[model samples]
Target: MTTKIRMTTPLVEMDGDEMTRIIWKMLKQTLIEPYVDLRTEYYDLGLEHRNETNDEVTVAAAHATRRLGVAVKCATVTPNAQRVEEYKLKEMWKSPNGTIRAILDGTVFRVPILVDCIEPFVRTWKKPITLARHAYGDIYRDVEMYIPGKGRAELVFTDGKGGETRLVVHDFEGSGVLLGMHNLDESIANFARACFRFALDMRQDLWFSTKDTISKKYDHRFKDIFAEIFESEYREKFEASRIEYFYTLIDDAVARAVRSEGGFIWACKNYDGDVMSDMVASAFGSLAMMSSVLVSPDGKYEYEAAHGTVTRHYYEHLKGNPTSTNPMATLFAWTGALRKRGELDGLADLAAFADRLERSSLRTIEEGVMTRDLGILSTHPSKKIVGSEEFLREIRLRLEKSGEAGRSCR
Candidate 1:
């Protein structure tokens, strides 16, 4: 029997909703607890509970993450009108992720988890591309209004003294909509530093994009900040690391990304990153194979699956049906949190366990045993499709065998 690894600090575990909540329990029981003497400061961010706490639980969880420095979150439900009615909520609660990102002021980094059996749809791609998304302030926090008729829209800023700056947004001939979105210089600088530091750490080229030609004031601010910070703060270190940083228009960046071989980091605004990450995930494979991490400026990290809660699979699970929902991203989320925790606490054995577990999972899929989604995308000749539970059990077997052999991937 293999002794469980001991943890010095507890991980902040945010439990989510629907099918992922089910898988969360299964993962802890099957693959984790049996091997590691796991410790977690747990928070239930499930939709029903969020509504019960009036979303205070989400705020509390974010604070706990800041206090603990590392968190692993399960995918939660972001309620729309339909979800509000389905879950019978008090009001349409805001996204827990949005609330957390706002409090943490973090940047999201998403990268694809590549396996040997699956080839990317993009023929030229030889490696994984990481997308760094500015996780605060865009249309997400915009204020909008419907014009009654023949009205004008203006953006106004007032100094506390007596000075005021006002600019006309639009003049309406007929009824139209007006929107105002804002971002902070502080947030933009943080985003730039995060990207630069990440690039230096990964030793990859950094590319940033904005539609500065059209939105001169707004988008140009982003470009200017990145350039100034790269020149002032990170240029010498980047030169020492032999990494490059460049800026281009978003459209041109997209075209370059599609044509070029993929081993670099692409930085984008909130909306563009939101859209392009999905496109890149699909072009490479499924969103289930993408790992997401939010890194705050102060070095706090939160790991989560890039995809949503498997709602359809949840319904199937309710009917006592075995579902083949992929758990790759969530598994990585756990490993990432564990690895970070181990590193911070100086626990080499714990860190080694995280590495070995990740290798075991990839080895499982590379050997042609996977869940339904990956099974469809995989071109392995001897494919063996399995349900979620069986797939995890297979991983458990590998974990146990690897543990017994005292194998170390690092």
Candidate 2:
């Protein structure tokens, strides 16, 4: 930037692990700190530190996000039994994302980072598609069990007023599987509002899908919630904007998405979002090029990459090889956080810097310079493929050029 950006509020910064972690520091050093006096409440969310703090640090970081109202996070590991053995942890810790989403009552939105040089895997896609997932509850928090042969499975709900209601989930004739999941009306309402508001902010049409025909009571509730919120609160605004809120069956949505030119907001429930977001990422580009954020109904934002820590690249790095790891999503995460902070705090310069950073990153790729992953996917005959650090350097140069444009416009 031509001049440093002044910020009124500090952002919650949750750092993470592996190759992305290495890229995180370079992103700030090369792109952010040079032009912005960034103020952040830093929490080391690296796997070892998480184990050391017994994951209290993760909880504290989530709380910090609520307090700060804007957060930028790196991709972190949610350990399993295998990871527990590898890292020597106290316990296989819960996903920091799950914890943060619960605490914030947020909706996760995934948007692909688009570039002209590379075509989407799906030939029909002509624009970007943003997927908003109701991340709070669903199968992620479900109660599941394998049915012993010839057993009855009933969902029991007690109102705490000495009244109980039971719904027969299954009356098994033989050995089978059973699962029960519950979502609160409050959370559903919050998710609806977040998705609708995000559609408004993004200026895109909103499409929500569920298997309500097959799941009248369970899945239908989500469809009902979105319609109720839209009709009650957002219907007028949506009409005024000349944008429509469309609902369809999940199967139909998939088929429509496959054939149609993509440019809209797709609202999905917990499990559908999990599956579709991955499909959407791969269909658009590498997961490393997708940007994700969690937005609370009240407008708190936490930005993160849609992908993992690039464990393979980290291993290669350990062997002293110059790994061509992609860092687009992580860079976008920082920019997203910065832009939210700027917008909320009335710091246009900071917001402009965020814009410039994004444009520069895109420009770098558009100019036929990119990391190997994207370079290989790109149609450019002579794309300059560079290693992770060198790729950041290329984007940094583009960002300086972006700064010049900002200076001239001012």
Q: Return the top candidate by lDDT.
A: 1
Clashing residue pairs found in predicted model 2 = none
Candidate 1's residue-wise lDDT over 68-110, tens digit each?
Answer: 9999999999999999899999998888888898889989999
Please report, as a residue range, the 10-residue window in candidate 1 with the lowest summed lDDT: 401-410
- Give the residue spans of candidate 2 off by over 4 A: 1-3, 144-153, 168-178, 403-410
**How many pairs of residues collide in each model?**
0, 0
| Model 1 stretches with alpha carbons more than 4 Å out | 146-150, 173-176, 403-410
Best candidate, TM-score = 1
Question: RMSD for each model, in Å, please?
Answer: 2.6, 3.3
lDDT of 1: 0.92
The TM-score obtained by model 2 is 0.92
